[model samples]
Target: MRLSQSLIPTLKETPAEAQIASHRLMLRAGLVRQMASGIYAWLPAGLRVLNKISAIVREEQAAAGAQELLMPTIQSADLWRESGRYEAYGKEMLRITDRHERDLLYGPTNEEMITSIMRESVKSYRELPQNLYHIQWKFRDEVRPRFGVLRGREFLMKDGYGFDLDYAGALLTYKKMMLAYMRTFQRIGITAIPMRADTGQIGGDLSHEFHILAPTGESGVFYDATFEAGDPAAAADVETFYEQMTTIYAATDEKHDLAAWEKIPDERRREGRGIEVGQIFYFGKKYSESMNFTVTGHDGTKIFPEMGSYGIGVSRLAGAIIEARHDEAGIIWPDAIAPFRAAILNLRQGDAATDKICNELHEKLGADCLYDDREERAGAKFAEADLMGHPWQIIAGPRGAANGQVELKRRATGERLELSVADALAKVMS
Candidate 1:
């Protein structure tokens, strides 16, 4: 995409309302704009990042055996009532009534809706183990939404539901999801530790929240250093991986175990703040029983299938990643999830040689490259490239272009090297 033809309205000054690094940077970088108190309109650049994150999530979820199926943002109030949470959900739910006088709501979550779907479709134990997921927008009407997308009222989420014939099967499915979540976070270039967490309104005895360590996080966290020593996705045994994760001493401030903290060696102790990005709950029959979702057992008896729900804050992750990875200059986007692979900057926008080199590089890189062809100073272009957080920057100035060379700068390390255009393209593509 050419910068001159793009709609990235980057700002030199940060918005006064943005209190966090992610919020401030996102606005100044022209990724999103506030549409209302707690709502935002994602710009083209922001949407690209969001879509990349969602793709990674979908891939990991599919690898873990979940089928993809989209659910609606609005749901009938009757579904929540069947699960006995219509009144209990509180004001966060934006309850609505249509002209026909029927109650409805912008769903905060899809647990009830999914449960009702399974109840109507699955009637036998033969179809017991089923997992379905969707990536969709959800609304909660946060009373005091802040921190940009991190605490936004309307946001994109990847929520999945799993059903099994018995408790053991449900537990196995939950473990699979844990592994999937770890892989997803790792692929997105972030380290997320799974800590035991309260089920809260979700109502489950077993729950875990995945948190990314960041200085500006809302929750103070205590964890073991082993979490960073190895990759959870490398473990071949799902049960062993799950056991090791749950047994480790990891918790948010609210659930910190002082006695357990002292038990670990001083050198192995690690504590910091964490921003929650995802959560998994093995709620068993919480939804199925209340909603009367039943399946026929082998002997013809009705059984309430054990169920679990897994969730990842799709939109919030874009902000959380910035919170964890940004530097003084701007966001240091991880290569895997960057909006574009590289930015091709024409240091001398109209210079015949520089423009030719940059245009060639842009064409070679195809849609993955952001070509800065705007009539802006070299310094301004550099600043915007850094602020937008492309993984690499290909700079073509008259001097370098005349010599058939271009400077390739790695955003994460601030390393620059003047190389032949061919070599630079190869490096960026590689």
Candidate 2:
């Protein structure tokens, strides 16, 4: 894509109202626009990033044996009433009515709906274990929605629900999701610690929250220092990984232990603020009992299946990644989820040789190279490239073009490599 053709409205200064690093950086880089309070419109660049994140979330979920499906943003109120959460959900649930006087709502979560679907279709113990998930926009009427997309009223959530026959079966499902979350965060270039958490609204006996440590976070968290990365190369056994992670001493504010914190050596103890991104809960029969989602056992007796729900804040991770990985210049995007793999900057656009070299390189590598053909100053192009945060930047200046050479820069590490056009292309492609 060419810079002149793209809709990236890069700002010269930080928007005055933006307070957090992610919010300010996103605005200054022209990634998103505020459509309304707590609601945002994703500009071209922002949407690209969102799509990249969603793709990764999808891959990890599927790898964990969850099937994907799409549910409507609007749902009937009768389902919630059957689950007895219609009145109990409070204002956070955005209740609405169509012209026909039927109560409908933008879903804050999808427990009741998933349960109903199960009751209607899945009938026996033969399909004892099933995991279904969807990536969709969810609305919650936050009284004081702030922190940019981190706490937005309407945001993208990846919610998955699992059903099984008994307590042991339900635990295996829970374990599977816990490992899935770990692998998902690792792919996004962030380390998330799973801590025992209270299932506040989701209503479950077993719960865990995935929190990424950041200095500019909203809430405090406590975790063990020993965090090993999940081996992507190895076949992940969710049950084994879940048991290993859960046994470690990690907890947020609600589950903190003073004695436990003191027991660890000073070097092994780490405390900091973290932004919560993923949550999992094992709510045995919570929705099934209320909604009467029953499946017949082998003995032909009707029984309520054990259940669990897993959630990841898809939209919020964009803001959180910047919070966790950026520096003073701008966002330091992870290469696995970057909007564009590389940028081609024409230092002297009017120079025929420079333009020719940039165009040829861009043709050779399409979406990987965003040719900055716009007639902007050298400094402006450099700033915009850094602010937009592509993984690699290729420079075609008058001097380099004359010598048939270009400069390649890694944005994450400010390292520049001078090479011929062929070498530069090979380096980036590699």
Candidate 3:
């Protein structure tokens, strides 16, 4: 799209409240605008990246046998009451009441609703081993929310639930999800290590939290070096592979065992701060039993379906990825989710030669090119290009345009190459 037509409100100075690089870069790049203390409106460029991430999640989940559907932002409180968590959930749940004075809430999670659906429709063991998921908005009322979108009050989440007939079956389902999560994160160019985690309010006996190691993270994570080199997704038998992938020592801050830490050799021990991006829990029949979601078992006796829940913080990963990948310059977005694959800088703007080369590149690259047709200074254009974090920067400067040449700068690596306009566009397109 043309730079003049887009809402690219590139800023010169950083916002004072942003202590983190991603937060500051997002604001300076005009990707988002703060609507309130803990809420921000995603601009066009920002939404593109978010949508790309969501699509990857959806594809991976579907490939792993989970059906996708969308859930509403608002839900009835009666479902929560049935699960005995209406009052127990406390202040984190943003409760509401309609004009009829009936209790309502913006759902922080969808456990109760999914349980209700299962109890109503799935009545026998024949329909067991089912998985369903949705990508939707969730609200959690945090008393002090900060870190840009990292700890936002209202955000997007991808939550999936699985149902199985027995404990053994439930574990198999959990293993499928484990592998799926690994594949999903890998596709997004993130290295998320699944570590044993505290279940928190979810009340599950078995839990794993996938964390992306970053210096300024909230959780102190300890793990073995094997996880760093292993491919959890390639397991022939998912359950067995899942067991192997999780066999190595890994734990969160609370569960970190000093004895275990000392047992590992110095060469294998690794400790670092990590951002939690996804979590999986096999809660067995916790919600199902509370909500009375029972069905006829294989032995013809009544039983509760062993259930598991998996979640990825879809919105928070944006900031978390930047936290892990950015440098002093700006955000270095992964190529798969970059808002634009490349930015065409028409240096010496309004000059016929510069315009001709840039326009040609834009036409060949299709709609993904962010052509900087603005009549701005070289410094201004360069800064904006870096701040936005396009994978490649094509400079159609006067000196090069006069020589039938253009400059291509690789943003991730500080490598610049000069080539003919034809060569440059072909290299970028390929």
Q: Which candidate number maximizes lDDT? A: 1
lDDT for each candidate structure: 0.94, 0.89, 0.89
Give the TM-scores of the predictions, in the order they appear: 0.99, 0.97, 0.96
Give stretches of model 1 more than 4 Å off. Answer: none
What's the lDDT for residue 186 in model 3? Answer: 89
Q: Count the backbone clashes (under 3 Å) in each candidate.
A: 0, 0, 0
RMSD of each: 0.9, 1.4, 1.5
In candidate 2, stretches whose alpha carbon ends up further than 4 angstroms from where it belongs are 228-236
Estimate, for each residue in 191-308, the C-alpha lDDT of model 3 and write its tens digit: 9999888788787899999999999899999998888787755668786778777778888787898988888888998899999999999999999999989899888999899999
Per-residue lDDT value at 372 in model 1: 93
Steric clash pairs (candidate 3) = none
**TM value for model 1:** 0.99
Winner on TM-score between 2 and 3 is 2
lDDT of 2 by residue, 85-154 (tens): 9999999999899999999999999998888888989999998799999999999999998889998999
TM-score of 3: 0.96
Q: Tens-digit lDDT track for model 1 on 277-355?
A: 9999999999999999999999999999999999999999999999999988899999988989899989887799998
Please give the distance, in angstroms, between residue 96's alpha carbon in candidate 2 and its true position after superposition: 0.7
